[model samples]
Target chain A: MSLILARIDDRLIHGQVTVGWSRILQPDQIVLCNDTIAADPWQSKIYKSAVPPDIDVSILNKESAAVFLNNLPLECKTILLVENPEDMFDLVRRGVKIDEVNAGGMHHSNSKYEMFEYVYVNRTDIAYLRRILNSGIPVNAQSVPGVKIHTIDKLALDAIESIMP
Target chain B: MINGLVVTHGELGVELVSVVEMIMGPVSGLTGRSNSGKSVSELADEIKELISSDNDCDTILFIDDFGGSCANAAQLAGAAGSSTRILTGVNLAMLLDFVTWRETMPIDELPRRLVEKGRQAITSMGPVQEG
Candidate 1:
């Protein structure tokens, strides 16, 4: 398994992920682990085409991805993509030894607590990822490359709590 | 005429414009959102107006994403004719070459340009395979 980078982003795949992230990491294979995207072929095609043509992309569900991660091929650098904490938790439960987890594009939304001006992590997501961190996985938040790192624990819980209704 | 439209969601369009201009010289189009930011649908309608206002013979609108509001709006606004192409995933290289070369070549040659420019932007950075 050439899985070097693992990221959790609700957008799954978009401009920031494809254009910005792809240029930095140059990951040959981008695997998006989301049940919804895997089930919908058309959605998969749309995301697949968004990525630079040279890079291969797979939209896999939780179970299949668990198996894929276990027996990852020894080849080019691969990036494991996920939409939320639940997916990450699922992988952890299935024994995906991801040392680091990146949080990207978790924009402001209803029911989400504001951790930063542009970032809002839901309580459930925070708790779940915290568990992963407590279990020994390091969860870091850097919207894009070359920005100051936002450690999951150091994330502004006060700011988030203030935004909660 | 191999015309193209660049529809940006946020300030990202500004960067796209620079990239496109670097490759294509000067061009005209719409950037989909205002600072206050209305819905993607609203932005699409405005872009539709911009394209329709030009009345160009052959146009290709490059939406940021196939699933984005601008791209969807382009589809909804109905630029489905053969002469008009709706492309998703607009990149700096694609915009630059497509716009710059379209002036010298016929619209029929656009497909080749898109492929060439797209391929040029890709650089393999990981482990190489042994044959």
Candidate 2:
């Protein structure tokens, strides 16, 4: 199938995805779906440099991304990258047939707590992730290929209790 | 915070950490050791002391080169505690990656992931990366 993996990573395309995941998934193309980057030409070029010469890179907004993904050749092996959980949520809401998303590299920030060394989230971030999970979409959290998969159990429970007294 | 030790020939390891600290702020859970004046056994003992004392978190030992005395000493020290992992050819990016990622990875897997992260950071300069 053309769509080998759909991934949501905060850092977008960097070393871990290019060298690490690409070695395992072997995608011929990488689609980065972000509204701001699509509108900005220079930012798009910067992301392009990070990708290998052999692989193709597409930076597009969600609406355009839906169209671009729909039109890709059936034989084309592609891995779609999005920076935010909401963007992935938006893609599926627009009817992109992404069944699952490999969640990776949510780097720590002051407002965020470290779930793992590479994965970070705030209370609000967990809620957004739950939205995807509740919609029957699987969010597998793991940084490198073949490493242990991080469960959303703690985040999910926090999301549930967040609404309660 | 996990523990880290950067081992290098002469004072390179010590100086690299100083540069890294300048760039990334004061890094916790990391130390730098140089084999400049110390014997292999002395260096190995220093590593073992740190590894044994850090009872809370896992430790990663970074070496500047492989097949050298520094690497040998690190490997010998790593044997005493399975918590210690030695990665050869440690660069600036690799050290940054190790400190950032040690929390997410088990001691057994941190070195592999850090190596990959370091490899990704290295590339021939291009205009697209310019500010």
Clashes in each model (backbone N, CA, C under 3 Å)? 1, 1
Evaluated at residue A160, the lDDT of candidate 2 is 43
Worst 10 residues of 2 chain B by lDDT: B18-27
- lDDT tens readout by residue for model 2, A62-108: 99999898888999999999987788888887778776777787777
Candidate 1 DockQ category? incorrect
Model 1 over residues A1-165: C-alpha lDDT tens digits? 477778888777765566556655778888899998899877787777667778888889999998988888777778888888778888988998787888765777778876654467777877787677777888788766655678766355545655667
Model 2 off-target regions past 4 Å?
A153-165, B1-131
- lDDT by residue for model 1 over B32-116, one digit each (tens)? 2331275756766776676677676567777666686777777876765566667667777677567546666765668567867
lDDT string for model 2 (B24-116, tens) is 445677888899888889998988887788788778888888899999897777643576677888898888667566677788777788889
Q: Best candidate, DockQ-wise?
A: 2
Q: List the candidates' TM-scores in order.
A: 0.57, 0.60
The residue pairs found clashing in candidate 1 are: A1-A72
Top TM-score prediction, candidate number: 2
Q: In model 2, what are the clashing residue pairs, if there are any?
A: A117-B104
